[model samples]
Target: MKLAALVIAAACLLAPPSLAAPWLRTRGLGRVINGTATDIADFPWMASMQILDNSGCGASVISSTWALTAAHCVLASQEMPGAYTTLRVGSSSRASGGVRLDVAQMIKHADFHMSTDDADNDIGVIQASEPFPLGSSVQVVNLPGDGYDAPAGLPVTISGWGATATEFNPVYLQRADMHVLDRDTCRDMMADVATVTLGMVCAGDPTMAICYGDSGSPLVYGDMQIGIASWTRPGCISTTSVYTSVGNFRAWIRDNTGV
Candidate 1:
């Protein structure tokens, strides 16, 4: 299927537009909100991959030995030699007892097109050198599959240490509550995309949207994770925040990453 068509079909059951001025710009500093683990040490896989100093990307643990993130995050590195050499996954707050697993392999979504707005198959998996310790307090998020579908209007939780506002990446993690948007509503919101397809899911309020730093963060609904923050329009505050729907590609993801 075409990228736009995939986004529409993938999100045919999902649901974007006004914008509010960004409140503040966080410089790699994240806030630990309520319900979040009290100690930074608790979240072992909630990491920020550093390309220099900025939190260029975010990733979540999906299995003891694998992590899920955006395909774009490792595309360049995979294409080149030794580009992602220092990539690390651990608490963005600091490096302590957290494991620094080398990215033994990277698998990008075949349909991902970096030049286009469509994020078809924008997902990717990073295999860690070692399995995350079972009782290490690092919990792997379960992915949505086998008829998993979030009901419309359901409230979902999305967390990231990305930029709090526009043009900046936060230093600490933050969580936001968002509602799922159906395909029709999202298409209208993504009117500029030429076409909205079946591989994408839209989330967040029109006024409060995910930003650049949030790419690859999990969009959790209930016990299953359904989406990954993939991209936002030119302005992060735009009503439509495109996500790579996990449910739509569950089989493909499992096959490629062997998770």
Candidate 2:
């Protein structure tokens, strides 16, 4: 009965939408990650996960009615369900001006265990109450397919409404460019902190890393989303930060969302 109940709950989350269809009509040249503020259209897939009208984590639209985010972002709300109330998409500013959608369901990874030191399988999918309007400022991002791998030293973009400085939250979206680090290097960097598992990807620059509120943000390479911001060193100023490997969980995502 317990297994049956868990299976029934997982079934309710459904699969994500297909990404073969293009949703974005325009692309901005401005780079994200450790950069300046971005226009709403700059990263159309970007979504803001909010609780009580305040932005708490970042997400990406996978379809009109589905989104991808960090499992930990919705962990607290899993039991209460009502804790997470809204998802704001198609906006660069977190404070205002976006299409707000009610969160109907949140599906976290079954293997996810927050108390574990590694934070393995930290991905989640969210179903919105309605489809997001497709336009120049709103769209879905492509996920990395099977066998797709991000080689170390590869540059990728990270975007979110996270704090620009310690304890300094920003109203506008910010982005920065970071390079993928090899597993060995990542393990070394995080040796004193959390365990860097194969299920996670590591990226960051010497001067920049994902800070508070950046959790669940996308790490993009070309047009494909490669990772989701999972955790950072205590100060968020570490030379490296870990991300939940989207490629590693692509099959799981497809199994859950069918996309």
Tell me the tens digit of each residue's lDDT in model 2 across 1-259. Answer: 0000000111112111231101100111111234567787879999988765677678899887889988867764564344545899877888788789999898999987655254688899988998898899999899988746689999998888765542244678887887999989898877766788888898888766776667788889976899998776544547777888999999988888878
**TM-score for each of the candidates:** 0.76, 0.84
lDDT of 2: 0.71
C-alpha lDDT of all candidate models, in order: 0.57, 0.71
Error of 2 at 165 (Å): 1.6
lDDT of 1 by residue, 1-259 (tens): 0000011111111111121111112222222222231243434446554433334566778887888877766563455333442234555452234455566777887777655444467788877777765445466777877445556687886766554432143455566677888867887877665345677787766555565456666777764688777765544546556677888888977897766
Backbone clashes counted, model 2: 8
User: After aligning candidate 2 to the native by TM-score, how far in Å is the CA of 178 from where it should be?
Assistant: 1.2
TM-score of 1: 0.76
Model 2 segments more than 4 A misplaced:
1-34, 79-82
